[model samples]
Target: MRSLRLGMTAVLVGVASACSALGGDDTDPAADLAADLAAALSEHSLGDVPLGDEAQRTAFAELVAPLDEVPVVVDVVDVLEVEEEGRAEATLAWRWEVSDAAAWEYETTVALTQGGDGSTWVVAWSPDDLAPGLAEGETVGLRTLTPQRGDITGDGGAVLVTERPVLRYGLDKTKVEGTQVARSARRIARILDVDAAAYAERAEAMGAEAFVEAVVLREDDALDVLPAFRRVPGALAVRDTLPLAPTREFAATLLGRVGPATAEVVEESGGRIVAGDEVGLSGLQARYDEQLRGSPGTAVVARGADDVLRTLFEVPATDGADLVTTLSPDLQQRAEDALATLGAGAPAAALVAIRPSDGAVLATANGEGAAGADLAATGQYAPGSTFKVVSSLALLRSGLAVDDVVSCPATTVVDGRSFKNYDDYPSSALGDIPFVQAIAQSCNTALITNADRLDPSDLSAAAAALGLGVDHDLGFGVYFGQVPPAETETGAAADLIGQGTVLASPFAMATVASSVVEGRTVLPVLLPDHEVQQVAPQVPLTGREAGTLRGLMRAVVTTGSGRFLLDVPGEIGAKTGTAEYGEPGAAGDLPTHAWMIATRGDLAVAVFVETGVSGSQTAGPVLEAFLR
Candidate 1:
C-alpha cells in the first residue's frame, strides 16, 4: 500500500512538470501573436495567421500584388514592444530584387493589436506596412534610366561615331480619322519609298493613339521629303539623334549597328538588359558591347491614381567610355573614294591599308560590289601572284638570288598537269631571265619550274615569316591568309604561284606588304590598346632579306606590269597578281581574280577585285588613286 502511494505521487509530479514546460499558464498571448504575424509576412501569406479578418487579409494581398513582378523577401528584425492595452509594434525588414545589379531594402514598423476579447490578435492594416510612405490607391513600379552610349574615335581623337541629328517619320493615328489612318500611312510609306501596303496594314492594326514609325533618316535626307510629308494629315516628323557615322556607308560593316534590344538579347542578359534598351548588333560594336554600354540607372517609384510619382530609391547612370581605334579618317576616306571609282555594278572589291612603321590599320574599305559584306577583313580568296612574294622568300632561303638566271618558259608541265603563263605574258621577257625579272613579270611557269628547289613545308614557313599564314586575334574579325603544304607535284607547282590550296584576305596581303617595309613580321592592329600576341615563325625574316625583297618589288614598278604606279609621287614597291578560278567561261578560259600590293613611304596597301582582267589592269589603278 505504501509503495503504490509513492508511485502515484511521482506520476502526478511528472504531469505538472510537463504542463509547465508546455507554457500551460505562463504563455504571453501578445508575444505569440507577434511571432505569428512575422511568419505570415515572411511567407507572404496570412491564411495561417489569426492577426487579420478575411477583408483585411484581402487588402494586404492586394497591397503586395505589385511585388509579384519582382522577388520579395521579408523577415522580422525585432518585436519592439507588447503593451497591456492589446497593442504592439514589430520591425520588419523587406528586400526586393529589382534587377540583377540592384536591390531595394528597408525596415518598416508594423502595428499589431489584440481583439476586444483580449485573446485574439489582429494586424492594423495599412499600406505603410508593405512600404514606408506608401498610400492607398498607389502602386510601385520600376523605371529604367538609359545611359549615354559611348562614341568611337579614330586617329588624332577624331570622332568616328557620335549622336547626330535625325528625323523619325511616322503616321499618328489620333491625328487622323479612323477611316483615313491607313490611307495616310500608305502616303507616308510611299513618300519614304518603303512597302506601302505593309505599312498601311500595320498602322490600321495599332491603337488609336499609336505612332507607327515609317523610317529614320539623317537630317539632311529628311529635307527632300519634308514638304511632301507635311501635306498628309496624320504624317508626322519627330527630331531625334542617334549614334551615326559621317555617312551611312562609312565603314558600315566594320562599325556595325545599334538598335532596340531583341528578345534573344533580353533573355541572354540575365536581367541586365530589358526590352527597349539600345544595344550593339554586330562587328566592333557587338564585340565590345559591354565596355561601350555603361551601367544604366534605376528608380523605384510609387505612382498614385492621380498620376503623380514619388521616388523611393534611385541609382544614377554611368556613362560609357569611348572606344579608340588606329584608323585615320582622312586615309579611310581616300581608300573609299578610290574604291568608289569602280562605279555601280562592279565586281566585289576590297582595299586594306596599314602603316608599315607601327602596323596601325589606316583604312579598310569595301566597294559597293561587296554589298554590306566585310570583304576587306574576312573575305578568303586565292591570292594569285601576290603570293609570289611568299614563294620568292622560300626560293631565296634555298640559295636563289635576285640576279640568279632562271628559265621563264611560256608553259611548263608537272605531274600530268600542264601549267602556262598568263596569256598576256610578255614575249620579250620569256625564255631565260634573271629571277627578279620573273617576279616583276609575274611568270607562272617560271615559279613552277623552280619548285624542285624547295620542300613542301618551305612555302608555309616563308609565309609565316611574312605574316601571311599565322592567325592572331586582333580584337576583330580577320583572316591572316593560309599556306598549307602541297600534297602532290601538280599541287606544288600551283602552290608555288599561290593558286592551289592557298587562300588570303586583302588584310593578310596588306600585312605582307607591311612586313616587307617594316623589316619584320608586321601584324596589323585596329584597336590601339588591345594586347596583340605574336606567333614566332619557324624561320624569322631578317632585315637583310626584307631589304633585298623590297628592291625586287621596286623593280616591278620600274620595268614590270606595276609601271602603272610610276606617276604616283613617292617611290613605290609593288607586285601584281592574276589568279584563275572556277570552270572555263564561254571564252574557253577561267575567270581571274585581280590583286595588287604596294608600299609607298609609310603606307602599305593591298587591293583586290573578285573578277577582273588582270591585277595591273583592274587593281593597279585603284592602288594608284589611293596613293595619289
Candidate 2:
C-alpha cells in the first residue's frame, strides 16, 4: 500500500512538470502573439496558429497576403491588461517599405485575447493591425505610368517621325467562327494590299481569341480602307498612335519603322520595356531607340472593392528628346521623283547626293521595289568601270602620266585568265592610246595588262584615299565599301576593274566623288551631336592628285562614254561603269549593273541601276535628271 501511494505521487508530479513547461503564468502571452504574427508575415504561411476559428484564420491570411508581400518589420513594445477580463492591449511599431518613392511607419495598438485555458493568447486580428488607418476592403497595388516618346527630326527642325494616329486592323480569331477565321484574314489582307494567302495561314495558327494584325495605316490613309473592313465578318480595328513618317515610302529604309516591341527587343531591353511597348525596328529609329524612348514613372496606389482608386505615391514621367537629322526634304523628294521616272518593273535602284564641301547627305532615295531595303545607303554593289577613278589615282601615284602610253587591246590575259573589252568597244581605239583616252573609253584590257605594275596595298591605299574600302561611323546604317586583297596577278587585274570582291555602296561611291570635287576626304554627317564627329582624312587627296583625277573625268564627258552629259549645265566631270557579275561563261552574258558618278558645282551624285546593259544608257539619264 505504501509503494502504490509513492507511484501515484510521482505520476502527478510528472504531469505537472510537463504542463508547466508547455504553458505558465510567467510567459508573456502578448509578446508570444506578436512573435507568431511576425514569423507568419515573414514567411507568408500560417502554420496551425489560431487567430480565431478556422474560417477566420483563412480570411485573415487572405486579407494580409498582399501586405505581407511588401517589405515589413514589426516590434512589440508593451502589453497591459485592458478594462475587460481576458482581454489585453499591446503596442507595436510597424515599418513598411512601400517603394522607392515612399516609406510608411506608425505605432498601432492591437487587442489581445486570452484563450479558455488562460495561459494561451492571440491578437484579435483586423486589417488595421497590419497598417494603421487601413480599413476593411482596401488593398495595395502598383501602377505603371508610361511616358510620351520623342520625335525624330531632320534638318531645319523637320519632324521626320512622330506619334501619328493610325488604325490597327486585324482578325480576331476567337470572335469569328472557326471556318471564318481564314476567310476574314484574307478579306482584311486584300483591303490592306498585303498578301492574302500568307495572312490566312497566320490567322489560323493564332489562339482562338488572339488578334492577328494585318496592317496599320495612317489615319488619313485608313479612311478609305476602313469602310471595306466593316463588310468582313470577325474584322476588328483599334485606333492607336505610332511613330511614323510622312508617307509609307519616305526614306523608309534609312528612317526605319516602329511597331510593337518584339520578344527579342523586349528581352534585350533588360526590364525597361514590357510586352506591349512600341520600339523601332530598323535604320536610325532602332539605332537611337533608347534615347528616343523616355523614362517611365511609377505610382503606388490603393483600391477598394467599390473600385475607388487612391494614389499613395506618384512619380511623373519624363519626355524624350528630339532627334535632329541633316536631311533636305525638298532634295529628297526630287531624288524620289527621278527614281519614279525609271518606270515600273524596273530593277531595284538608288540615287544618293551629297554636299562636296561639308559631306552633308542632302538626298537619298531607293527606287520602286526597293522600299525598306535601304539600297541607297546600305546596298553593296560592284562599282564597275566607275572604280577606274581609284585606279587612275593609283596609276598617277605610281609614276604614270595622264598622257602615258598604255596598250588598249581587244583581249588581254593575266595569269592565264583572259579579259576582254565590252561587246561594243570601238575597234578603232583598240591599239595603244593615252591613259586619259583609255579611261574615257573604259578599256578593260589597258588596265588589266597594267595590273602587274601595281600591288594590292597600292590599290587599297588609293581607294582608301577616295573613301572606298574604309570604315566610318556615320551615326546610322552605312556600308562604306570593301576592298579584299588581290593576292594574285589575275585578282589584281579584276581589282583594277572593281571586281573580285571589290564592293561599294552608292553612299560610299557618292562620298568618293565628293572627295575628288573637294580635293579632300568628304565625311558624311546625318545626325548632329548624336554621332561621332567626322574626322579629317588620314590620307587626304593632294591638289595635284585631285586635279589629275578631274582632268581624266572631264575627258570622259567630252569624248568618251559620258559624252551625253556634255550638254548639261554645270557639268564639270563624269564616269560611267558597267560591272559583270555571276557565274563565268554563259552566266556572265546576263545584263550588268549600270553605274554613273558625276560632280556638278557644289553637288556630287552617284546613281545605280541593278540590271542595265550600259552605264551611259541607263544610269546616265538618271544623273541628268538629278542635275537638272
Candidate 3:
C-alpha cells in the first residue's frame, strides 16, 4: 500500500493511472471522493464525508439551510495545495444576487489522513469549513421597509391632505352565497351612500373572494354608522388610512388623490417605486410625487430557523417631508358652497380667491361634478367682460383718464363684423359716458370702438401688467391666458373684449384682480416651500394705474354689472365680463361666457359661468354669495 493524499485536482490527474492499476475506473476511491465533494457542495449538503456520520450531516445542513433563506448563488473557484499524505485546500465563492453583484470568496482547508490500509482518505469535517465565520445554527434573511409619506397642510396648519382613518366597506364575492351576492352588494352600497346598481355590477365582475370596495367613509363619519353596516350580509369592513381632505368635494380637482402607483408611474420612477406602492395620482399630488414619497430601506440578516438573531447589512429608510400649502379650509368651503348654489347641470363654473397682500391662493373651488378637470385653476374659457380691466389699464396708459368721455353705443362694427352690447342694452347707458361709467355698464361696444387708440401689443402688454399672459412659475397646471398679435382690425376689436383667441382660467382672472389691489403684479402662490415663484411681469402696473384701475372697478360694483354687490358690507371694487362665444343662434345672438372679478381688502376673487346669459345675471350672484 502506498501512502496517498488526494485533492480535487489530483483525483482528475491520476484517473487513467489508477484506472489501469485497478483494471476498472468504477472502483477508484479518488473518483468516488471527488464526486462526493462536488455533489455535496452543489446541493449545499454534506454527503458521506465522515464514516457513519449523522452528526456531521446535521451540522452542515444547518449552515447551508441559511443559503436557501437568502437564496445564495455559489461558484467553485479552484482546489490546490495537495501533498501526498497531508492536506488539501479548496476555494469557493458565494453571492446574494438580490443585494449586490460582488461575491464573498473564501478558502476552505481540509486535512486528509490516509486510512491505515492505504487505499482511502477520510475528511476531518467541521461546520465552519462550509463558509468562513458561519456558525452551526445561523441562517440568512431579508427585510424591506418603506418610509412614511409626506402630509399636505393648508393655511393655519389645517391638514388638507393627510392620512386619515376610513372604513372601506365592500363585498367579498366568494364569501357570499350566489343568490345573496347582488343583494348584499346593494345593501352595502346603500349604507355607504354609493350607487347600488354600480356596486352590483362591479361585484359580479370580480373573481370569487375578490374584495370590491363600495365606499370609503371617514372614521368619524362612519363610527356611529358602522355597526348597522356590519349587520348586512356579505358586507365586510376594513379600517385603513388614506390621504384625504376634510370633505370629499373639498378642492378635489386641485389636491387630487393618492392611490397605488400605476404601471406607467412605476416605470417612470426608475427603481424608486415598486408594485403596490401608493403615490399621488393627479393634481398637486401627481406634480409633487417625488418629494412626497420618501426613500425605502433594505437589510440582509441571518438567524436561527426559529429566531432572528443577527443583521449582516442594513440601509435605513428616510422619511418624507411635509408639503405646506396656502389654502384656507374656511374659504375653500365657502367657495364650494357658492358654486353649488347654481343648481344641478349648471354650466362649468369656478371661483378662485387670492390674498393681495402676499399673493397666497386662499381658495380654488370648481363646481361640483366638474368632470375631474381642475376648472378652478386650469380651465381655459374667455374671461368675457372680466378682461375689461386689462383694456382699461391699456387705455389709462395711453393717457385716457377714467373720467375721459368714451362713447357707449348699442352696437359697433369693425372690419364688416358687428360687435353688440349684451341683450337688453340699457337705453339710458347708450350715450357718450365717462370711461369709468362705460366699464361699470360693461359697455362692450365702447371698448370695441376704442380699439384703434392703442396697438395690438398694447392690450397684451396691459394684460401682462395684470399678471395675465406672463409665466407665473406656478407649480401646478394653469392656463394664465393667451393674446396673439391683433394683425387685423377685427382681431384687435375682439381682443378689446377678451374674445377671439383670448382665454383665461378663473385662477388667472383672480390673479389679475389681485394685481390691481396690490398695485403691482400679484403672483398666486400655492406651495410656499417650493422654490418656484410666480415670475413678475416685465411691465407691472404703476401706482397711479392701479389707483385708476381700482376706481374704475369700484364703479363696476357701484353702478355697473356688479351693482348687485352694492348692498353688501365690504368695500368692493369689480369688473364684469360677458364674452360672446359659439356660432350665432337663429336670432343671431351668440352664447355668452359670464365673468365677474371683485376685490375687498386683501381678498380678490374671480368667477366664471360658461353659457351664462350675462355677467350681471349669471356670475354676479355667485360672487355676491361668496362675498357675503
Which candidate number has the best TM-score? Answer: 1
- What is the TM-score (0 to 1) of candidate 2? 0.79
Please rank every candidate by TM-score, starting with the best.
Answer: 1, 2, 3
Among residues 3 or more apart in sequence or in different chains, the pairs in candidate 1 whose N, CA or C atoms overlap within 3 Å are: none
lDDT of 3 by residue, 189-252 (tens): 8877899998898898788879888777787778776787888877788889988888888999
Error of 2 at 435 (Å): 3.8
- Lowest summed lDDT across 10 adjacent residues in model 3 is found at 1-10
Off by over 4 Å in 3: 1-141, 172-215, 220-228, 299-314, 533-538, 583-588
Clashes of each: 0, 1, 5
Candidate 2 at residue 523, lDDT?
81
User: Rank order by lDDT, top first?
Assistant: 1, 2, 3
lDDT of 1 at 378: 96
| Model 2 spans with C-alpha error above 4 angstroms | 1-135, 171-186, 193-212, 267-272, 304-308, 321-324, 368-372, 403-418, 425-434, 449-456, 473-477, 530-539, 566-572, 584-588
Comparison by TM-score, 1 against 2, better one: 1
Q: Which has the better lDDT: candidate 1, or candidate 2? A: 1
- Displacement of the residue 2 alpha carbon in candidate 3, Å: 36
How much is 150 displaced in model 1, in angstroms?
2.9
Model 2, residue 394: displacement in angstroms?
A: 1.3
Error of 3 at 20 (Å): 30
